[model samples]
Target: MNGGDGPSSYARNSAYQRGAIEAAGALLREEIHKRLDLANHTRSSFTIADFGCSSGPNTLLAIDIIIQALLHKFSSSTADVKTPEFQVFLNDLSHSDFNALFALLPPQSQRPYFVAGVPGSFYGNLFPKASLNLAHSSCALNWLSDLPPELTDTTSPAHNRGRIFYTGASAEVAQAYSCQFKKDIKSFLVARSRELAEDGLMALIVPGVPDGFLDSQASTGSEFDLVGSCCWAII
Candidate 1:
């Protein structure tokens, strides 16, 4: 979901998404140009969806970059239309504070893009089929839909007694998290695939760990990892 802090808290921690969006400038520009060209520069409007847009100005940055890219592509064109209206959807979970998001929106006088809020989980299809020209999300995929059950199943071999996460646990623990993650991501991909237009582009920013890195290297492994590690060491 699009949530971090009530307002500023989320924005302050969104440096990752912000940096990812900026780094994707070339890719975004290329896709925008391609879509514009495909429409023969005659389409009257463009639609974009920012899935999992948690609160704050960070969402603003990403969408602004996308809108700017479109404008740039059409700037030198001979398209009959001056500038097509941009429709941006800011999506998050049902509980996301869309009010806070709207409060931060730039006035129409300062920007041409029209904005709307979409409330729901992005793990499923949230838009109409072939309705979007672009879909974007960043720094939010690391979250799994649910904790791996085996980790807390006292009777299960993979039980991670006394710990809250999989880090520093046995291979079985990591495998559980991995398996659930795969399932969640596959569902996500399937939903988005059906929603995107034939020419639509999706841009995503996912956090990374080095190849060969183990659960021990989880960048922000929960505090339970320390206790779990000590328990393992004592055993």
Candidate 2:
């Protein structure tokens, strides 16, 4: 996520997706504003969580979209309202470059946000119940929180030997990946459900594979076919 500016450096290379991601976020702005309206929200403060927020400038586009939507709501309210202050949480794996992400953050004087990093797998709970007003994710959900355990167990009969993924593998291999994806997504949803406010809004963007490619039903695996081609490497 840091250091040299190359394909490996997410911060330096991720702008390729910024245009699309920001466009997607813009589409959600009106919807987010409506959600705030429906919630009858009048608070001058709010919290937002960005799950799997890898270190990059692209993440900020989505975060700001959500923040600006709420601010727009406050500005248009019939009653006098003060500008809202935002508390933003950027989440990713423990080894993620949180310092790099923080370094990119605007100074306190430039923005009305208090930013913090919450490092962990998104499949588990990261915040207290009802703590989040909005949750966002982009190009992250396609990855399982953990590798499909059955793929490594010989005795369990679901070993995914010789295949990186289940795309063209035996039915058992496909089933194993499917089952693992379902479990991961279920855990992720349950965790988020617990953490978000009742009226909270969530936005997620997933990159999808083309037709005929196999991936977790709950996920879109764009490079998944590569798994079948590179299957022998693992063996």
lDDT tens digits by residue: candidate 2, 6-85: 56798777764676687786678878766664335556668899998888877787787777787787777675566667
The prediction achieving the highest lDDT against the true structure is 1
lDDT of each: 0.78, 0.77
TM-score of each: 0.83, 0.83
lDDT of 1 at 89: 92
RMSD of 1: 4.2
Highest TM-score: give the candidate number. 1
